[model samples]
Target: MNQETKQIFSLRKFKTGTHSALLAKYGIVLATTAALMGAGAVSADEVTTPQTQPTTEVVAPATDQTSANVGTPAQEQSAVTSDIPTSVPADTTQDQAVTAVDNAQTTLKDNVSTAKDTGVVVKEGDTQEVVINNGNAAEKTSEVLTDLNQQDKAVKEATEKQAANQKAYEETSAEHERVVKEGQEHLEQSTAEVYQLIDQAKKTGLLVTETTTDQTPEYKDTKGLTGDELRTDMAENLELYQAAIKAGIALQDKSVADLKAALALYQANQKAYTQGNTALKDAKSSGVAELEGADGRQGQVIDLAKKNDVTIDVKHETVTPNYTDVKGLTGDALLKAINDNIALYTQAVVDSVAKQDGSTKDAQAKLDAYLKLLADYQAGKGTQSGIKWAENTTVEAGTAQRMTGNEPAVSWGNLRTAAADAIQSLDRNQNTDATFDHIFKINGSGTVIIKNTTNGDVTLKISNIQAWTAENTYLAVWGAKDGGIAWGVFATTHGTVTGGAGEGATGGNVGATGAILAMVKSYDYEVSTSNAVSTVTFNDIDNNQTVTLNGLDGAKLVKGRNVTQSGNSYSAGAGDVSQASGGVIDSNGIQFNLADAKTVTFSGSHFLPGYINTSIVAGIFGVASEVPKEPKKPNLEVQNVDVTVPEAPEAPKPISVAVQKATVTAPDAPEAPAPVEVSVHYYKMTTTPEEPTPTPTTPVQKAAVLPETGEAGSILSVIGGVLLSGLGIVGVRKRKED
Candidate 1:
């Protein structure tokens, strides 16, 4: 093997040796790749379903190194790209192949770093295969980069959704507040209107006193409330207020109408009373004028006798008519006294003329005129006074007209006895002849007659007296119908008379030759203010028949013990005779029967009529109905909005990427390249293990035990061992090549 032969032989030996070493290195690479692929291969069953939808993004390799903080989408893509090599160098020299292998190893480490930075969790007991092939390595790196970008997109979408939900919640809450405020205002206004109506009714006196307080509704305060609670309470309160307004207005209208009606009735009654009072006054004035004319005529008769020179003595000796003195008299007393004096004077003139020697024609004519005047004065029709004279008659039946505002003609006690005798005579059933005397009859304005035929001394007496005048004053009158009985007392305010002539009897001093000597004697009576009126009584000795007088003065009548007649009956122990035999007495009076000689009495009082008048006024004026008050407003409770604050999308739950190792062969390999283990990072989007909900009685449950994936520390140890073994093989091959 000279120089040429030796050179050729040396080169051949080196090529053979280099080929064997390369093949041995390839074998070692294949074996290591197989082991890494086997460790990284994870079954689909082991992987859990993703909690969220997976998003994909294709990431192109970057030209420049990027920041480690993968916070933004662009930053994340750049960071992942910085970890991957652009291309694999050709393995021509031993050092170059070693450098290429070193670059591949560095790429793998960078990818793992990027994975950690991007929040890709590498579960324990999981192996990753890093392919050193020129074409497939970039593809694997792009998968990891894509996962980072997809995670960022998911986070952005989640944040936008959360913002939209929050805005919607705010809008709903605002609308609810507006509705509540408006509703409350409406309720308050309605309540105020109702109160106004109530106040108006009271001020106008239209409110009914009896039910105003009880019917009035109370007000309620609503101070604190919010949201739907306030709205609902306001709605209910509004309804109540509206109802109160309606009812209050209606009540006011009714009260107004009632008041109008009552006022109208009161006015009508008052007008009627006024007219009646006027008529009463006119009638009283006419009686006074007629009585005055009678006095003038009596004077003329006396003067005419004197002018004729008839030798008629002014004083005649004869029984003079009973006459009361006319002095310091007023009202009905003065009128009666004057009339009586005139009648007595006229009688004196007649007696004196009869005793004279001759009576002149003028004297006779004047005397007759005086007689007619006297008769006219005695009857109630001429004087317009409430007095009437009934001449004595033999007939057993007669009628008398009822007269008002009249005084009694005779002593009431004596008259009662006479009436009792007359009534009792009817019960005797006797046939003896009887004389019926005309007695004074008195009552309200109407005619009432008494007819009886009997044998006993039948003396009839009827006395019903009343004063028709204004509220505070009254007029009363009384006079005898005829001069039949003797020795009667006539008392008046002016004076009194005690002794009088009997019926058809005359007495006086008379001279001889038929000449009048002295005036006739008059009745004797005691003058006293206290004995002005006689005591009136009714004594029934037989205890039989009942006497009922109806339509008496309501103010004067009083109910005695056991009185049974309606309308202010004063009889004691009387039977119920409201419906009497003659007719129903629809006015104030008394009913009584003579039981065991019982006597009914009367007493005067002035206060009762005034009280009755007051009652009438009250009935006319008081008319109204109750006024209702405002209804209560409801109290609303605070209602806080149940706002579910949307969580800030949880940052897309840190998309979990499964770093799986896969083997791929290079299509452009000069020889069979070692099977490359590529770590393809993808977003599995698995959820973190959640803690189970705890029951009321049990303690909080811990996070569910995740499926056993080896611990992180052990996985790192396996990776370290695999890396060391690969490095050792490269170093040995390099040492041999050197």
Candidate 2:
């Protein structure tokens, strides 16, 4: 046989012998393709190829065939040549077959690599046998290879997408962590600031406690949180704190103002107290005292230099006695001596009137003057004249009826006794009598004669008597031994006497004598006076006064009885003496009857505003009530604030991208190859089949035609076409043998 024919025959023999083996071998490939199809790895249309016409050929006999074969080599060659299309060259067919086989192998390798890279596992399943008809086996195989490549691409894309998803998730998680950390730090810082403010407020004396109202800022715990939750918590807390601080500051300002007002009030009260004390001091020193009138008719005098804003000048006089005969005597002896003088004087006057004659004008004038003098003496008004006749009066001894009528004897025996008793009972330290007037001190000793001319009774008298007036004037009367009357009147005033008792004759009228005696019984002697006096004067000067009491030498003047006295010094009581006498008498003997004798008077003067007790002034304007306490300062204290940084969002789970095994569905097997005509030559044969003689024809060497720039699927198509042709040849040969 020729070389091409011999190759054909050899392929046919191989196909017949390994048909079952081929089915088994390709079963896995078919199953893999089905798996890819089930997984939607590739489209069916992408794996399918166009069908091609089948070529008819002779099948080669098995290796065990006998030599008694009928067909010769030449005839076999002719049959194969007839089955081939006349329009196509034999060499071109051989080239297509070679290229097809190369493509198939490349496609298979690519599929396997994709499966490994994408982690696609091929699971076991019922092995499907894909029988490819020779007519379009190459195209079908090309389509199958294309499907496999597409499957691989889909898996790669899925892997890439999954990686991208993982990357995005990681980035998001990192951002979340950073935000959480920053938020936590910010929250901590804010909390510290709040605490610092609170501490400062406390230092300023602010009272700060936890927030009790929503309007004030308060602490918030934010732990184990992140993202929106953390942000929201921090924002709310910050707002509260800010509001609280603002309110606190306002309160502090108000407190300061209140304290200032309180301080001012306190100062004002203190100033008022100081002024009041000054005014009180001036009132105490403004009073002045003065004495007037010699008889003690007006006692001590006191004047206020300032009395409701007016000033006054106090004036006074002093008197000196002409005869101080009663200056040293005290008690009963003084009263008696006074009474004896009155009696002697009365007798002399009566005798002088008796000697006067009633015929001449001269004699009558002298008698009238004598009678007027006697009358004045009895009334206590003739103190300046002695008991004697007036000037220009001359009388001769003559018988004249007595100018005075007969009168009874006048006596003050009770007065003399009572006066003596009062003097003896006078107390030195106490005022025994409320109306006690004055002490007339008596001293010198004297003697006098008393003669009664009316009855020719004469009596010798030695004067050693004491006298004083109590509440009235009194006259003394005495009776002579020879039945004659002796009487006299006592006078407070003093004068010199010029005539003697014997120079007068006894010829006076009894009426004159009787009138003189009757006048002594009607005298009233009640008077009111005090040792101390107070007078208030108004003035307009606000100054202190220096009170100088002038005449209080033997007596001591005490201020509100606030003084010390020793020995014979007298104590003068405080306040007005008219209400109650406070003067104490001593052994030195104060003369209350004489104005200038032992009295007190004010010497200096000044002005005073008003009278107010010193003690009360101090208490009224004392310190003001306690100042308003400073309001507690506003404090907003917050300790450490815990904040939770939310855990970084879990890295987004890597996106699951299923990259199934890149499988290709085998193209539906091409239609069965058309039947090839075969001519069988019969020959008588013995036991073995005869072998046909090989023909000496020239061999056609065809180059395989491969797609220059195409996927491996194209080559697989050509390879499948060649294999199917070989199978077709084998089937035709076997049918001819039957």
Candidate 3:
């Protein structure tokens, strides 16, 4: 191991308890919160598709860990990718998984960077299939047919939409109902009277524009306008016009109300945005995350499904700052308390939440300051209304608003921002709910999903939430009316799962991660001695990347350098792997697939020649699906057209004649058997190859035939046969004479 790696690892050594707790925490937390994975081909985490999709299943009671019954890591790994990517290491699966942590810490920066910048993981899972040439074809086709038929059955799901339907509907319906109810009651009369007054008021030069008048909206009559009209009626009543004509009347009351509401929304947006900016800056300051020096925003994660591509959804979540109670406060103490709480609440989301938790010291400390400020104020430092600052202007712990010569005097804007943060997140129990904007400005915001699957296999859900175009990002989505979770999609990718390791939650007071994360405003910002402020966060550079780790011994971690196996194996550092060519392996020549490599072949040649006969073989290294040839027809056709048949005419029998070889030689060429030419060529027959019938073998009649003896026996037989035949001929002649 290199010296730098050893040093890094020594610094990263975890206490036994911390390591164990972290493992358990992550196992549990990750169970609740999985990576917001690419719906596309992702190796980060496999989609935990449920087996049997639910057939009136009995719910397994909640347990400390999920997937207990599903299988152990052994069973799961065996079923799929086998090993490498998903499971850290066989050793790492032990309690606390220290070795795995060491390995992960080394690769965290690369993994994170990949996820953020490229959304690509470094390690990918391997997917392969080998079709068996057995007799399951018909059965498989039948099963597919059966499944298709079953899909036509419509199942009415009545247990509510069951999941993502939890929140949007109720909120939306309530808002809609309010307008409907208002329309049925005081809509028309109010509309006509208001319009008349507005018109008359306009004639009297009381207002310059029609939009700012007491005009009624189109209802049914646009009943959707009832709520808005009611607010309008409340502000621009004819009574206000009459009051305006009076001697001491303030004629611009209606205008003032309109401006206030608009201003309120604007201020709320502006403050929240400013806090968001500050929180990010502070997070960078706190060393939680960095500017990344990335020039262009991706803005390209889009669904490739549309022409003009209507946006699916854009959402924002603002948190009402959470406050701890401080009973009383005054002067610098009260201001200090407010500022402290604001900083803490903001940091939680900005530093901790966004960066996957941790880093909320500023938020927690602020609450403590609030309590102190309250105590001091209740003891009577400031008046009931407010406290006056000491004329000395000497800066101390909590007295002066300004800290040092480096920091300028606190401006009204700063005071407003800090106060706004405090009030927005003010504790209602403390009768301090008036700071709505202040509390909400420092909380979480923004969520998005990228899915690339477009095979008509999409599942989507967007829950209850208000929509607004902020910073010019657009999203239009379909969602459940009252659901809390919004927007869902399905995507696909091409490669396998890669360098993905589950991460543990940041230590939050609540002790777990949320379904979504937002900016935190709870980190402190102090100018560092080097003129840098609050810069202390760990960033994973490889956004969604796969990491190849070495020395997962918990004894060491190495980065930006190669790893050694026994004698001579090696794996390049994160940057080196991509930059340098070829596969990565340890010194022992063990090339593990961390970056989702399909296969590795160092050097070889093709000597086998019994390959393709006609045309060229287009198949690449692996799957033959790449080769283009004729599609295979499994069962070949066989026909029986060669049936045997006996069909012809019978031949006539001729008189038989016996002739001796030497005794009777046909001197005249046997007279050619003479000119006896057959008039008709008797019968003709044809034969063809066919399965022949087997003849049975037997030991009957003492076995068989002797054709003739030898040369002497043949001579004897010839003479004897000739003599006997001649005698028989003489005897026949004698018999005929008698």
Candidate 4:
């Protein structure tokens, strides 16, 4: 082990009951408290957020060692980040002073040593003999103890004043930090609002101005363009959108710059406060070390005296501070009592140091002068007062106010119908009490607004239409009315149309009264032509549905006709139906077809014919009908014609073959067949191929057959004799068969 490690281990092995061990424990306590106080006084200057969103700052809690559930060292350190004072509290300072005095007194009583050999206790054999003499060294040691006890009081009072000053600095600095943070949060929120506004403008087509040239060259390469490129192209094409985006970006930059400037000031102040607190902490810690070191040296001085031949008489009693009680006294009476307490504590210092070594004589003289000043102040003779000096100065922290701004306009739209429909879609069984609080967007536009009010009869105003169009677009909003129809279409006129039908909540009719099936607001229709076909799309404030129309012949104008307005006066000329003459209905041009009909087709000469129920209305017409029936037939022509049939070819004929007869012939007489000869030969191989060795067996040989020898001869003889007779019979039989 290293020398340092061995020393530390040896120190740890000391008994807890020893005087040095107690001093070590108290020393550690003092050091720990000092470190914590220093750290806490400075950490408040370093608060910061880890995210873009504003964070609520939490003030650190101070540690109280007296609590039963006091946390572990790590936790205690964490909690002691702010509000902890670097200087000791008055109560703690007082306690330390009293404890130190008690320790000094006890040590003096225990150490039996003196500079003179008088008053020595000699032990001879089993008996102890005491030699008594008046010793000047013992008397001097007692006076020294008394003086150190008095010095403790002055240190305690000084500590209290330092603590109060530190508290004021901490509180004021914390307030300044809070104000700075609020400024930062305000800027962040302001920037966020600007961004939200820009986003809304981009989404609702506000960023897009009406461009006349559809096939602009810059957009021709859009097929392979990235997201940013596409946005840039659109912005460049639309002057208003481009301007809006620039404004938003500029606002964000300005807000951030302002925030940064404010933050810089805040950081500067925080740094100054932290540095000041750190300096104060260092001073307090040094003072504590000095006081404890002086206390430790007192014990060493007594130990040295004991080693010498001098014998000292120990004092058994400890000196405690005494003060005159002034309870029930008011004003100056109480003040006088406090002054006297200070004076008495001071005088003790003078008395204790007077008999000490000549080196401490200077300190004794200074204490005596201070005691005389306090006595004169009690007698009202001097202007210098100790009470005034001991008191703390009051400090007030500055105010911090949070910044405020108008809520951002995300988007606004006519949401009367959309709100109603969303409300209707909610589960009636589960949330019957739920009210409509939804916002719907204008079709193809960034503008969105919601009908937040619950009152049924209220009319909602649509704002900011001038940004999109100079022309006035009127809407006839329909809403649900009482009993006349389960579904009603209502219209309330805003512009020039007077005595308009559907003015109030009523049933469907041509004038003044219309069924309230749905209400459309802030509606607009856009048309574009390409390849001889014009596409028409309608956008409304109602978000519940949309309408799109395609395949309209460009040469002919396709019109919108409110099916409810059926009178001859409302009828449009061949191609006169336009945005100016309003006949628009629910999204997708969907209308409830309650009329009983066998077939229906929404077709016109100017448009490509398609099923009106399925194509134009998205088949909502089928469900909107009062009664279910066969689907509508598309507008087209059909006919029937006969088909020709051909006869099958005849099967192929089978092939034929002629039969031939076989005949037997008999040769003339008695030629016997010659006997076949057979012969056998044998040879032996020397080696086998597989084993490379051959075992030979006996070879048998037979002569070539000689007609089986005599047997064949005898058979041939018999056959020749029989052949002679058979030949004659066979010739006769063959002749008869032929």
Candidate 5:
């Protein structure tokens, strides 16, 4: 029989519109093409067989098909029968039918095996193949590549984090070392400065006062410590300080109690000292100590003079009580008698003290001896050591007070009127012009004089009383030599005077003036002579009052000047000399003569401006001089230590990091079912199946082109030739029969 068959496969199913489905379709196309070629070859062989030849019509002995279970029901029902003509051999028909049956059975077995492995069902006795869908591997590959890219980026970020953290740690460590070194240097310098300050204080006599005890209580135990031991202890303390600085603590922030410990060390070292070598040298050069010694000797002289009934003058001059009593003594007897006299003996002590060398030790010893001898003499014991004979008479001890109270105040007007009257009274027709209210000229000399008419004390205030031109003259103002009112200038200059040129009882026209008052005494009107080698003489015309100096030099005079008057009032003056109270002439108003008077003497009670005991005026005239130079400030450098920076903080630990990877998900694929074979049904059964009619052509799809199957030149051409030759043979036989 001729048959046409269509087979349907039971294979794995998949959803459409997905990557997996697309892959399944492509696999099915390949499998179906191969199966179609095999079927075409078999159909060509069937068509070429000879139709006129006889074939066997074989009928098998009937068996119960219902009881058979070798295959499907359709297989059991199906049978093949062939009719053979008389001209053909019966064996040939039987053999041809049997061979056909064997071929069908073999094909069914092959299809069943293929269906099981591919998860597809094949139709029995048919050459059509079943397709199984596989998973979509292409989609998974794309996802895996994307995840790897993300992992690469994360690794790069982690590496950068580690590098940054490492750099920071290194920088912090370097800064820490630098800060430590700075702190070490600061500590060393600070220690050295502290020690230097202590050592200087100890060497000098600038003793630490008791006030430092409260500031430095912790240093109480430093009393017996040597300088080396103290320095060693101080160095040891720096170690503790260094540790604190390293740990980020400020040195200044330490407790007050702790700071006191350092201060205490300095105080203890300087307790008995006063001043450094610089000040001591200055004091020695200036003869300050010597002057003080002379003062003590003068005091001794006074005590001895008073005890031995000597007639000492008000000026502390004239050491002998009665010079007339020793006039008859001569030669060695005169010298022995003068040496035995208490007044000359004390005078010798005073002279010796005045001539002391400018040395601290010598002056101190002289002062001590004089003080002790005076103490003995005052206690009715004669001079301790044998008196050394001397000629000069200069003994200074106590200070005199200025007259005070509501006494009539003297002004420039009062002094001017008095000066005019004195000149007019002394010489008629003498030109006495008042240049200023307080300055005047007399006898063609720039000199004037005034008298005190008040019964009580009166203050004589003078302003601009200076030697302005070359004609150096004298000015004199006097009171009762017995009045004992002292005269002084609040400020004075030996060389030049300027500005203070007006006068009033309360106010005047003058600029602010600095106090030139001496520490001991300063004279108001001082005039130097023009002669290159002459002497200025302070001629005490009235010897009723004597004027004595602390020493031969004016530099040793104690400043007894009061502050200048301002607004109808005078300053509360300073110094024992300036505030001296009594009936003493305090003003320096006396006649000055630029002539050769070798010795400048003071035997009057009047304080005279013409006589300053200093060599500036007392030296040979026309010789320039100045007061001794003041001691210089100590040459000490306070080395300050620099503040240190705190140590750098420790570096933080590095960050732990890593890149995160992405997850990849491929499209889900359908699982393949096991394969099986089923019964086959034919579309048409006739002597020969007719060829199918051709359909309209369809447009091909654009898709991935599969590789070449290799059937183009050989397999397809052989199959087509077989089919054509079979058709030609069949047609030739038909025409002959016609």
Candidate 6:
């Protein structure tokens, strides 16, 4: 120690400690108290627990005796040994304190003696180093704690921002997935439908390719394609609809054409069959069962040939016995009547033959000249036999001329004039003779006179008569027709003929007796005596009875009936023509069967009141003309289609996909946390010095190990502050010094 420092330290002990009372002898330790005061986290309210603590319990013995004298300063003084003092005394020399007194004082300063808050108090005996250092420690700890809290706040904000970003990312990602999924599903369904269309087109022969691949990529990606491409895609799906309509039209056309062809074919076959059937039913056959219509009249005779007992219409081979006419003096006999001697002429021959000669060759030649006449006779003759007599009578052969407007028979004068005119056309040979008396009386079958007129010859044969169908015609000058051997001597005589040519001669040449010659050359016929009663029924396919037509010319019809007319002819009514309707027999003398009013019924067609259908009219034409009608078209309903087919491919592709990353703002670096400002306020309930309690709660910063010049700047900054203060103080001091 320096000599003055030793003196100063000695005197500081006595002044700051009661030990200084005894340290009147020695006082060097007192200055060390200031160093102790600067030690740790001691504050104004801190209960400073000294690092070098002394035992306070031992001091309790002293304080208990002090409380016994409670209200006195002298009593508190007694609690401390007389060697200690309450405050430092300024005067006693520091080199004089007793050694034992300094020890006691030092012990009191290091340990807590009472529990009271004094806010920072430094006594001379206190450890200043320790107090100051403790305060510095507390301040440093507070700063460290503040830094930790600020970091924690920053971390919490960063965590919140990360969570929110995560939540948003999850929601956005989910929505994206949903939209993509639904769109994809729609595309897949559309593709399937298109595939069906493709298959249909292929099966219907519309597709170009015949493989399943035609259906692949059926759904059109319609992104950018247009115009023709769009139309093609639509067509692929609906071609079947178009095809159905086309097929319907084709079928209708074909049906109409086929029906037209069928109608034509049926008509041709009907006409050919009718002609063959008619020729079959009109041959004269004996004992033939005749079919009859309701009206009475013998049907046209037919020969039914039997093939295995089944009756069929006979052809030419199915003949029955019939009589036919034969000419006796048709050629040779007529010429002989002209070339013979006059004595040979006979009146009978003259009447019937017009003239006669006793020559056979000339008679035969004349008859042959009139071949047409023979044909007329043969047609109604049935069959001809040997001719016994022949004649060429010159009687009138014309219609009884009508008076017009349906008047009665022609006058007898006209008939006579016609007869005379025909007689003039005879041969003019002198050997022959002919007269009006040649007109033979007719009975039932042919022209015959029972008594002779000139030669007195009875029972004679006659020639054929001439008459036609007329209203008042002479009816062929005979009542009936017959062939075969008839009654009487041969009608070979004209009216009368004197002997001219040969007599009783039978030679190829002319007979000398002309009258005998004419007699021998004539067609043989007979007069009959049967009553010509009409018996009958006609072709009524319903009846199988014969209709015998006698000479019904005079038969009168019943009343209330009329005959209808058709074309150039007249048709019979269902009932007989009657006088009540101003008509007798039918104009053609046909009798109707009035019974049951014979009917011609029809099926679904209606005939006009007085008009008949063609089919019905033709039935009485004794013929049929059944042409077929047009064929009917088939009637059918349209049908719905059922089909399964693949679809066609799409026209153009259309799809787009894109992805981009989210550019999130860095979660705005957690904002700087707000600064901490801890305010320290001080208050007290009461303050008393009686128990001298010391407390320290709030800490202050001071002591820090000086860094190796890193904190020198801060130190220098503190020094500058101190320099500014020191300059002001120096200015005051210099002014005072001045």
| Model number with the top lDDT | 1
TM-score for each candidate, following the candidate numbering:
0.20, 0.17, 0.12, 0.12, 0.17, 0.18
lDDT, candidates in the order shown: 0.28, 0.26, 0.22, 0.26, 0.27, 0.23
Q: In lDDT terms, how accurate is model 6?
A: 0.23
Q: What is the lDDT of residue 347 in candidate 6?
A: 23
| Candidate 3 per-residue C-alpha lDDT over 425-538 given as tens digits, one digit per residue, 9 for 90 to 100 | 111121121211111111122222212111001111111211111111111111111111111111111222212111111112211122111111111111101111111110
Ordered by lDDT, highest first, the candidates read 1, 5, 2, 4, 6, 3
Compare candidates 1 and 6 on lDDT and give the better one.
1
Candidate 1 lDDT at 603 equals: 25
Stretches of candidate 5 above 4 Å error?
1-135, 195-348, 351-738
- Mind giving the per-residue lDDT tens digits that candidate 4 earns over 659-706? 111111111111121211111111111221222334436442222332
Model 2 weakest lDDT span, ten residues long: 613-622
lDDT of 1 by residue, 1-738 (tens): 000001011111122344334433443443333333333422222332222211111332121212223233322432212232322212122233234434444454455454444333322223233332332332333333332333333232222323333333344335434543454354345444444544444443333232331122342333333324434444444444445444554554454444444334333433333332333334334433443343344445456545543233332223344556434443344444445455454444444333331223334433433343344444421211111122321322123332231323223223322222222121322111112232323232222222111101122322222122211111111112221111111111112222221111112211122111111112111111111111112111011112334322322232323334434323332122221111112232222222221112222211112111100000000000001122122121111111111111111111111111111111110111111121222222112232454445644332234233533223324444665566557546644664
Q: How many pairs in model 1 have backbone atoms within 3 A of each other, for residues 3 or more apart or on separate chains, i.e. clashes?
A: 19
Per-candidate count of clashing residue pairs (backbone under 3 Å): 19, 68, 107, 24, 44, 149
Candidate 6: 10-residue stretch with minimal lDDT: 617-626
Error of 6 at 602 (Å): 37
The top-ranked prediction according to TM-score is 1
lDDT of 5: 0.27
